[model samples]
Target: MMYISRRERFSAAHKLWNYEFSDEKNIEIYDKCANANFHGHNYELIVTLRGEIDKSTGYVFDLKKLSEILNQRVINKLDHKNLNLDVDFLKDLIPTAENIAFAIWNEIEAELKTANCQLHKIKLIETENNFVEYYGQMQS
Candidate 1:
């Protein structure tokens, strides 16, 4: 088996909200992030795939297929959109980089099944200082 990876980028905005808390309480808890005004990030996404390379192509997976899947599913939905208001997943869940990473992983995983590939990991970089990773396994 061989592993292959691809990277892409998009910009989006979101806010964190907790329903259990009062509007004012959530605002105080999340501060700027809780603001209705929202904030944006230039997100970098890395997707890794693992599978046996095809003998004819000598590749674990086709880069064009991977890029197309990402562009069609992830980048199209997320790029230049307001995550909190525009994305169904983020409508309830906080749009933190961590949650966003998991959502992206789920989206890509669904597409990968049809392509005969396994998703290895998803890395989301919210900024130079903040990043998150989802490897699709429970840590012992």
Candidate 2:
């Protein structure tokens, strides 16, 4: 099997909200992350796919297809938007780097299936200091 990866970037903002906690409690627990005013991150995303190269094309998967899928599923929804106010998925879930990475993996997984490829992993860098990785496998 061969592995290939593509990278993309976007900027967005969000605040973590937990309905189970009072606004005050949420603020105390999440600190700046609970700010109603929101905070932004210049997010960098890396998507990896693994599969056997098609002998006819000499490629594991078509780069054009990957670019189109990433653009349609991730870039369009996240670029220059506020995750707290603009994305439906974040309406109910925290928009932390981990959650965002998982969401991206889920979104792109379906699209990749159509091309006979698997969404292997997503690495999301929320900042130079913080990032998350989602590999579509359960670790023991």
Once superposed on the true structure, which residue ranges of model 1 sit more than 4 Å away at CA? 114-116
Clashes counted in candidate 1 amount to: 0
lDDT of 1 at 27: 80
For candidate 2, lDDT tens digit of each residue in 9-56? 999988888889898899888899888788888989999998877778
As for model 1, its CA RMSD to the true structure in angstroms is 2.2
lDDT of each: 0.85, 0.84
lDDT of 1 by residue, 15-128 (tens): 888778999999888888887788888999999888887777787788999999999989989999999779765557778888898888877787786354688889899999
After TM-score superposition, the amount by which residue 127's alpha carbon in candidate 1 deviates from its true location, in angstroms, is 0.7
lDDT (C-alpha) at residue 9 in model 2: 93
